[model samples]
Target: MSLNKETIRVMNVNIYCEYNISEKPPLILIHGYLSSTYTFHRIMSKLSENYSVIAIDLPGFGRSEKSKSFRYSFENYAQLIKEVMDYFHITRVTLVGHSMGGQVSLNVAKFYPEKVSKLILLNSSGYLKRANQLLILSSYLPFFHRYVHYHINKHDVKEELKKVLFNHSLITDEMMEEYKRPLLEKDFPHSLIRLLRHREGDLSSQDLNQIYTPALLIWGKQDEVVPFKVGQKLASELPNANLIAYDQAGHLITEEKPVEVVEQILKFA
Candidate 1:
């Protein structure tokens, strides 16, 4: 598929996105924290064959603007997504979100049900509380962003990738390069601090129940980041949902099992 890349101004922030033309309802792919549209590269081409796939880099991550002024909460992110749909003249979409992106997708489905046709979450972060009080308090410190940069700078990209992927063999130089790309930006750390301070806790069970949209929850049984049990809980709480587990997969199920992920998305959406 020929992917078209563009940067559109939404809500005063320049948002970066990649899309392929198709006649079917669009598929909006949202990546996890510290990730970009690259996370969905494996499935983008194939998925675009059936649906117009629009993969985005949420503010503060990927190629999108890392504005210090942008509200880094899920609600704001959901609103930005809605504006994106309007920009593209898309009426409805199948939201495919992974990890933090999944939480953002949940927010969209919960608040803008009319704009969503289906919801698919991959090892999505759910029912988690916000940052600890101590961390929130420290965020007020003038130089806290530098500390955040220091902490993240200390970790090797390859090791970090290992923590998210069950199949370490998939780790390649290209993967490390893409994962580390955002870290090179001087403004990224500041935006991350703003995110930690502004991000609210995940949606509660009451909130999830309100969303009656058809949902599919795909979990990586070996996922240590967001355990498979979370998926089980989500399935139980989401009024209309189905849960599928891949025993050999980890948090980065999109990378580990893209073929199966596409199959499930096609069957469900």
Candidate 2:
């Protein structure tokens, strides 16, 4: 597959994205906290063969321009997706969101149902109540929020990846570099802080119930970050959804089981 990386100015922000043009009803891949389009690299080629695959670095993450103007809120990210879709002249899409991406997908499902024809939440965040008192309090103090993610070296990145992604063999040195790329950014701390504090304002149970879009929930049975029970709760809450729990996988199920994930997505989307 040809790698096509492009950038477009969106409201003064330089939004970077990767695209592979193909069949219609495009597939929009959204990544979670501290991640960019890199997280969806493995599956992008496979999906691109069948459908147009568009993966974006939402404002603060990946190669996208990060500034204080665009607050790292779910609604903001959802709006960005809408803008990108409009720019590309895409009328509808099959939205696939993993982790924090799931929250943004839910926000779009709640507000912009016309743009999203299908919704897939993979070990998504934003379901459970996540108001960390320490984090919240730290956000108020100057530079304290910055201090939280200031020290991100390779060792810590690997250890963090170990918790989220099962199967240590997949955690190669090159993979570590890809995961650490965004961590080295000067504004990474601010982006991390925004995600840490504002992520709590995610979809509620009522929001899940209200999402009538055809949805698929693929989760790892051993997901330590979000937990399998959370996926279960979300599947039950969603009016039209199916939950598929895979064994020997964790929060980074997309990376762990890309083949199965692509299979599931192809079957559903």
lDDT of 2 by residue, 72-113 (tens): 767777888898888888989999999989989999888899
On the 0 to 100 scale, the lDDT of residue 128 in model 2 is 58
Model 1 pairs in collision: none
Model 2: which ten-residue window has the lowest total lDDT? 145-154
- Off-target runs (Cα >4 Å) in candidate 1 are none
Each candidate's root-mean-square deviation in Å? 0.8, 1.9
**How does model 1 score by TM-score?**
0.98
TM-score of each: 0.98, 0.93
- Per-residue lDDT over 103-218 for candidate 1, one digit per residue giving the tens place of the 0 to 100 score: 99999998899999999999999999999989999989998888999988999999999999999999999999999999989999988998998899999999999999999999
> How many clashes does the backbone of model 2 have?
0
lDDT of 1 at 35: 96
- Alpha-carbon shift of residue 200 in model 2 (angstroms): 4.7
Candidate lDDT scores, in order, read 0.93, 0.85
